[model samples]
Target: MSQPMIDPFGREVSYLRVSVTDRCDFRCVYCMAEDMTFLPKREVLTLEELDRLCSAFVDKGVRKLRLTGGEPLVRKNIMSLIRNLSRHLDSGKLEELTITTNGSQLARFADELAECGVRRLNVSMDTMDAAKFKTITRWGDLGKVMDGLRAATEAGLSIKINMVALKGVNEHEIVPMMRWCHDNGYDLTLIETMPLGEIDEDRTDQYLPLSLVRARIAEDFTLTDIPYKTGGPARYVEVKETGGRLGFITPMTHNFCESCNRVRVTCTGMLYMCLGQDDSADLRAALRASESNDLLYDAIDEAIGRKPKGHDFIIDRRTRQPAVSRHMSVTGG
Candidate 1:
């Protein structure tokens, strides 16, 4: 008889996104409100514990590791963590070592990061308008982000622009932003906003769905489908060879759960099955207790088992459940 998987929720877990810090230098309105609580220091996992978690999961089946956070670069010793992961992780098992940053401090660490192990870097820059930029990030400067992007690109990191399509805010700037990235040979991915935990709810309508966003861009440039690569989320198309590509992630408009391979690890060390659902296994507690592989594997098993049939948010013909969170950044959307 086949061995039955035994995880918290009891499936094989893969694709771990490790959030390194709960602190971010930028105050994007979507993630934090004036009264929102910052992640307290006691709850965050140490670098060693974080490293141990990755080491444990590599054996189980984790193939993709994305370093995320309120902003990962804000972490004190990110390069050290990157270098450690580069050495300890079996690159054969962990295929992608990437990061999602707000680009506020990337320039300071871009080359160091490339030297450590990161291949591709995704920078979240929604609009190029200086006034709007300040307004959106709430006192953050755009020039710092611009400098960071240039430095990372120069350091040889494959760059992708991650723009959240918030209507009446950055939506109108979409075409200009796409053209700029396309001309400069960088991939631009337009993301739909998800109402998940930690996402400030007041600006929910600002999220422009992918279909409408794509149609708006198509009015100017023609897009031909880029064939499937690794089957990761984004569907890619090119703008005829200015050297860049356009990628779309339609999470809110079209769910891609059939191919979903992602398992998330929050900064606090819980392994989450889905973004909207709160079912998680406490890997941190296990790590602290000096648990063996059996317990470690058990945590992975439990987390994967809870991976819902799908994150179906729409109410069409069947009953729909509410989402897991009120924001996206905390969940690494």
Candidate 2:
């Protein structure tokens, strides 16, 4: 009914990534500290509230919706939110409803997700080695994730593996991981380590630029640029040898903010226009102020108007502090 959200740079904001919960089962070395404090349940928006907020975005011309989190599947009764949002897909108002997860609980939720009209999932898996997986994800079991992946495929859910290119951590696993993904009929996407939140280890030791990874892949495999897009920032290429698609998300080496058409909302109802910036609008306050959406719509428009032309992200070697104080999980990983 209203005009579609258009940022100041003329980019239409059609993709919305919402963080259902900030609580994750695993504390990854790059994502969170071993011992972390999570938000109180009272502060988080209820499942019904999330559904209403998401439907509001769909009405405002958001065709693609991605549910992200500390691990979206870890949230209790998350399937209800998925099923409720599926109505948008049924009514032809939304194009897709996808989830980005760590694959810990996919084994239990994959079939339900597919049944609820979720066609695709982005699973974050850095290494196939069990030891390395344990090291990366402090509390994760490689066996469980592997089982989850198998179950996801069996459920008819298209999966894309999102591997963060860690310098010395998983750099050696790139070729192996790519091959594994292709062998299992899954697309592989390598993402550069973003400078967000303070972790146990220094990020400088883990920052692996995708440009370097691309050159390394070229030595073993022929990569041809492709025009494939998944409503995200990843630039894709086709691997001639593997006959699979490889995507590169270079936030540090090369930023892709010029074409950013997405915004993120935390589970607490904070709308973030940019991931690397701290500017945001508290939509929860607006939502609670009234039962009507008149105030919510106005808050969304004001947030879009304040969206920056591009985010300014940097990984300083001298200081270990992150560009943004909020953790990646807090911003809807």
Candidate 3:
């Protein structure tokens, strides 16, 4: 039997989110500031180092692996990394290997991804309107994203569209987006805007609660609670008469920290214990200083031991504030 990566809270940490690069093609207002500085190439972990680090975790019993980035596909030769990481799936060490992309570059790599053993994808698409999409993502071309979505669907990859609901921005498009997803045979997940990093928009004005979203959704369709677990924090529900399902990820209104079973490693190899907190361990330094895998394991174990019971997001009546200070783009959110 393998040793399980159990945190101090007694939750089995079986999922790993790896940020391959901090470089992104689009600048979303809610994720980071427009004038962003990315990490130098020399500072980020090499592919071999990432493979070794991930192998260490798999040896300790992590079964689910997710590759993320400012835009994962933008990382040069990402297909090579996908092929290398896919070995765990074939060996039965990993139950799933997935990636979360901005969908800006998926059309170019959809077929190669499927051939490389990547079967699941979470694509971020906040709005369907071309002008609104361009507004939300500073330089995004919605037509390109649509082409990518179509190609991925045709490639036989399970597709899920993640929409971040901003109060005055794209909240009105909730029902429309859901309808589109239902019509296209795709799953939709609505996420509340989190206060991470120095975003261009005011966090107070943009933060939309999932409760309000659920109410808005219920007005048009009856939602039946569905027993579905996507290995993440989203709560699933089936939209009546639609073959597709809807998910709500409420980080501000309701924190799912108690049942959290994942740990994130940034492009620079900083291990974040919680998404909404600043607690982290520098695995890059350990990997660079030592050749033994035991050193890397000890650092991960210590970080998990210090994981907080819950996030510090406070929501009093209608006011809300996030306790985290890191940028979502850099942390692989």
lDDT of each: 0.74, 0.93, 0.88
Q: For residues 1-333, what per-residue lDDT tens digits would candidate 3 score against the true structure?
A: 236778787999999999998988999999888899888888999988888888888888888999999999998888888899888888888999999999989899999999988898999999999999999999899999999999999999999999999888899998989999989989999998777777766788787899988987788789998989889999999998676899999988878787899999999999998887898999998898898887888888888888878777753445444467678889996
Query: Which tens-of-lDDT digit does each residue in 199-284 have in candidate 1?
Result: 44444556677899788777877788887443357888887735468888887787766666777788888777777577778988
Q: 104-126, model 2: which lDDT tens digit per residue?
A: 99999999999999999999999
Cα lDDT for residue 259, model 2?
A: 96
Candidate 2 stretches with Cα past 4 Å from truth are none
**Ten-residue region with minimum lDDT total, candidate 2:** 312-321
The C-alpha stretches of model 1 lying farther than 4 A from their native spots are: 1-13, 89-91, 198-201, 228-231, 241-243, 314-322
Backbone clashes under 3 angstroms, per model: 17, 0, 0
Give the candidate order by descending TM-score: 2, 3, 1
Residue 77 lDDT (model 1)? 83
Query: What TM-score goes with each of the models?
Result: 0.89, 0.99, 0.96
